[model samples]
Target: MPLSSRLPILLACVVALGGCAGHPKGVMSPVAVSNKTGGSKVDMLVVTSRVPSDDPATLFTGERSPHPYLTDISVSIPSDSKRKAGTVQWPKKLPPNPDTDFAVTRVQQLKSVDQGRTWFRAHVVGGHALVFVHGFNNRYEDSVFRFAQIIHDSGAKVTPILFTWPSRASLFDYNYDKESTNYSRVAFEQTLRTLANDPNVKDITVMAHSMGTWLAMESLRQMAIRDGRVAPKIDNVILASPDIDVDVFARQWTEMGEKRPKFTIFVSQDDRALAASRFISGDVQRLGAINPADEPYRSKLEQAGITVIDLTKVKGGDSLNHGKFAESPQIVQLIGQRLVTGQTLTDSNVSLGQGVTAVIAGGV
Candidate 1:
């Protein structure tokens, strides 16, 4: 109950953001574009609700923008042999070697909806699009690079779109980041509506992690209330390490109407980031840290027809265990092949888990 007691919990979250010290934030260097080394490339369309920054490298700051901004970012990922799957190899310095680190190759600002449409025609394939919402404490470049790695490693053949909100990207600004989600909820809803209304988009998957999951769900809930149902074209939803309170998510799900997208959640009971989140959120359990086999949750998720994957036992990536969904090879591949592609993960597809336990709705 005391502030002193909460300090320790707050410090735990600092671990997630403390690692990137002394590095320049959001730098896009042309140097990486010259890389002839055999690596991979991922170009993504970005939509943001942060204030534009004067610094070109830091295109957007954590301050809420009056309107959304759009850009296209390209990141160069090292060769498969050089880097491990499911990890963003952050560059140590500017003008990074594309062969050794993830580097930004290009940054182009979009002035109008026509430009965004052009990008979709040029890059989107098979009428499939995957929109990614990054977690709290992420810079513009952080989301860009991380999503690039996910696309490159998972080998998902779809248009990649990133939706980023104002996150100070500091451990101390958790409340600000939480409020920012609410501020951007309408904008995010508009984004999904645009994608759903687009004639070129047939199948859509929305992948959101941590606090972004809260934003995603809220936006969808608003859409459900306004449009009578979530967009039919956006049929798959993946929530990874969601930082939302379990009880709150239940209410959100209820408001989403019967025509909601199929939901799949990646949970890890041992996630320390969520442990901190729980402390800040009045000691309520976060959706991402719930035990899929536990009481209430098990029966509730089953009745709701939601798939749950328990990643507590799965190892490797993010010592805090908050990013297993993206950091695990099997999990990322499953996301690309199953969830993102709109294929239901049935018992036959359980092999994709590799070793992580998966519980399909209706008790798999």
Candidate 2:
């Protein structure tokens, strides 16, 4: 059936699945992240194009903004839970509970920095920063805790930053999210350029998931086009289950020339979420769900020198199989061990488990 006819059904399905158990809300924790190096409390920096809520009752809302803003925050994970990547356990309690085990605290604006150094000097070092651009339907609080979770789980020693574009935070808002991703490209570009040019930041690793991958690609391509060169400090580009048209991805890459960062794409053929996205996109295969073993897709990725990993067989805790990159322990361990080290995911250098397969740029 056509999407027009199935729109109501799709919306209903989305609403049913939109419930996130143990999602964080309200006032953040006041505990200092300095208490533990890799302990429960984690400090995270936020860069967002979402408009701040006018009412003080709400810090930020699901509205889009013309300009970008930066914030620093501290998020605390449950002490009983493991700090492993690809794993998340929400507190037993629901919202409106101040005593909830997990909290996001200590949020302050980055008003000034001494000689380009962030307020959290311990987190920023060796000129390294890790930026995570979130996927579709994420709200302000969602992005903050997610990035904090990622930073804590990955054991990354660099500064943790999250770039949040405005999301309608609704299951039925797919079209709106797509347009919002495009609309936030300018602010995203500005954030990247600022990080790249900062003397305190020697290099930056960017990770984008779902629709954020589309925005990230467009922003980087636009930056390259306008500046006549890409930033060398933009070292690693990791896309997790990208919900983008393969053809558009190729065009974005082609426009960047040969100076772009090493590309790592995480794909899964069993991603039902991408299947829905493909349906919505008029049956155009999403870049994340393409089978690397197949023709055309494999050939195109090889030609473009993009590293594609096939994680279809890996059984994840998440039922959708869409967020394995951040929800699978094995993949998260792999990311922590290899990808974050600024190492290339070439055939000769990579190690894979029984289910995971690596398709290098030079061929299988």
Which number leads on lDDT?
Answer: 1
Candidate 1, 1-364: lDDT as tens digits? 7857886667765565445456656666445455467897888999999998877777888899979989988888888988989988877777687888888778889998778888898897898999999998888778888899888878898999999999998887888999999999998999999888888899889999999999999999999999999999988999999999988999999999888888999998889889888876789999999998888888888899999988888884756788888898888888887778777766665875446778888632
Worst 10 residues of 2 by lDDT: 93-102
lDDT of 1: 0.86
Residue 257 lDDT (model 1): 89
* Per-residue lDDT value at 129 in model 2: 83
Count of steric clashes across candidates, in order:
0, 5
Residue-wise C-alpha lDDT for candidate 2, range 170-206, written one tens digit per residue = 7778888999999999988888888887777888888
Q: Using TM-score as the measure, which candidate wins?
A: 1
What is the model-wide C-alpha lDDT for candidate 2?
0.75
